[model samples]
Target chain A: MDAESTAASKGALVDLDEATCWSLLGPAGIGRLSWTSGGKPFVVPVNYRVSDGRLEVVTAAYSAIARECDDAFVALEADSTDAEHHAGWSVLVQGTAAIDFQHPSSDGPRPWPAGVRRQLLVITPASVTGRRLT
Target chain B: MDAESTAASKGALVDLDEATCWSLLGPAGIGRLSWTSGGKPFVVPVNYRVSDGRLEVVTAAYSAIARECDDAFVALEADSTDAEHHAGWSVLVQGTAAIDFQHPSSDGPRPWPAGVRRQLLVITPASVTGRRLT
Candidate 1:
């Protein structure tokens, strides 16, 4: 509590605007996906790619993500941290998930695992927010 | 698709049992916390510690995690991966979070950001699951 109290008086929270948030998403290909199934929440890491204001990803047709994320509201996050240095930045994208079955995944990030990840999904964000801890 | 098919026929998925799940959690103090806020899912990482089958953490009183995680069902995950080798493992804890105001967060994992993280919380897990991609 001593450290916390002293630190609280000089909070270093920085707000990241929309453009900055998108920029942070630019060089990142892996992120965590949060989604709900039957009213309970779950989170898992996925290989992702973002461009033109949209987040794109693919998963195995029978994987848990493919089964749970169709038409669901989800949040995807990517971050960089240096714990020993006490510095980090995080970006969160909250949106409605839409599965694209027609075109299929052409040229985008692939699944990390050894499998046929045929499920192509896209997220149209309702809001994008980010923050930096300096 | 060619790479996927080859990998699929030789799937490298490995199941991680309860004991292994806890072992992977050892010495790791940071992880992502997933919780639902107003019927939508969200995730943020936090500093966390595990002991005696319980996961303990603290957060700023006014932070989003403190407000949404009390008495709520949440999922916490920690993982390590090597992209070049496609090797990774993840552990997930699903449970009900309880806020302990009387205890007042004494000698536990504290928040990383410089703030008064007074919300002392404990998660009693209902299930612990894990997986390894070799």
Candidate 2:
């Protein structure tokens, strides 16, 4: 809760500031995208890039994520861990997703396992919050 | 979507078999839980353990996860990656959640951030699926 790392022990979750949260979001490069469809919640890992506060990701037209997430409210999360020390940090963004066809293909890194990533999903983050396990 | 890793070039998503999916989920101990409340999606990082196909997790009673997830449909994911190789695997479990007061505390590891984790949530996975970026 406190910004001071001293107040937190290993594995203690500390609430992160907005600035720190966004800073973490940038370098993580990849994260999980969570969305709901037909009353079932689904979390899919995505190759993403954050630029100007918007999260950009590429998904196949037939992938579950693209099928369920476009034009829907979704959550994107990225995190890192120091497994040896049992510590880590996670950033979660709650936002609305839409197909950004106009987004240039060069905007971010393409999804791995290269395929027809015809749909470009952009999540305009409405709230960004994070926590660090120190 | 083929199971053959070769057919899936780097970034091409390959659908994973059920057995492989569970295997990957076990070693990847931490993942994001995606849930919906008030029609908005929330994804929170959780330290989880898998036993006999059940996903067991602990959450602070006062935290957002416990408040919105009990007795709800939720998804738990676990995965791993070789960042240098630009390849990874992700597993998703869609299931129902309930407050398992009778669940033995000995069932799984305690939540990080030593605090009041008053709720024990058990998700009886209805569907288990996965994909690998090979």
Candidate 3:
């Protein structure tokens, strides 16, 4: 069975279609970027913008993300939850990250932390999957 | 330099001590769990509770997390951010995960998704690190 059917069997989660996943990713937002470093997984929250079918995040040149994620396979997870209502939707993007110095748009999403975040890492997605909690 | 000094040099990020990291983890809340599967990384949002100096989360027995994370090294990241102010703090827990059928608590955090989520994954943290955006 595929992911959708597997989630369907759970009864509480409904698999979202690819189109819906992209829609929920929105034009810009916050998400968590995860990657393996030194044989252990690391995750950190980041601000991102969706542009030209890719997700882009700016980071300080010396940040761990910039240092470890360039040319790496990573995952970015974004979601919105109403904990009080016990409802939310999450989208996961599996992708290859590369530092995009060539086409770094001047209007891309800025890093939240106060710093000279001049490096832009663009994630070219390999798969986009999502599920909604009912 | 250590993690604290590395972050200090960035100027915009302040390294949070171990005590502060635990304090921010609080008694219970939401976080993102990340681990490697098939040599690739995956991350998902999860509801969690802190107990006995460890973090616990419930997942469907057949869920991806349950299937892949047992006896594995994983990371859990939780944070609070005010997008408008561009300020917030994030805490990261790097640990080992084990399914705790031996001591499944009756009052542990329940899964947000509707399901027979009876399996409890206990994460005994090896390192608790955090940083705050200035």
Q: For this target, which candidate reaches the highest DockQ against the unseen true structure?
A: 1
Write candidate 3's Cα lDDT for B1-134 as tens digits.
55455344543678999999999999998999999988789988899999999999988788998899999999999999888667889999999999887765445787767546678899999999999986
Candidate with top TM-score is 1
After aligning candidate 2 to the native by TM-score, how far in Å is the CA of B132 from where it should be? 1.4
Candidate 1: where are CA atoms >4 Å away? Answer: A1-11, B1-5, B8-11
DockQ of each: 0.56, 0.51, 0.41
Q: Per-residue alpha-carbon lDDT of model 3 for A1-134, expressed as tens digits?
A: 55455444543678999999999999999999999998799999899999999999988788899899999999999999888777899999999999887765445787766546678999999999999987
Of the candidates numbered 1 and 2, which has the greater lDDT value?
Answer: 1
* Residue A14 in model 2: lDDT: 82
Candidate 1 lDDT, B14-76, residue by residue in tens: 879999999999955678888998878887778888867989888878888778999999999
Ranking, TM-score, top scorer first: 1, 3, 2
State the lDDT at B84 in candidate 1. Answer: 81
Best by lDDT: 3
lDDT of each: 0.81, 0.79, 0.87
lDDT of 3 at B38: 83
lDDT of each residue in A1-134, candidate 2, tens digit only: 44344235535678999899998887538788888788777787788877677888887678777778889999988888776777789988999998877866545656776755667888999889998988
Model 1 backbone overlap count: 0
Docking class of 3: acceptable
User: How many Å off is the CA of B87 in candidate 3?
Assistant: 0.8
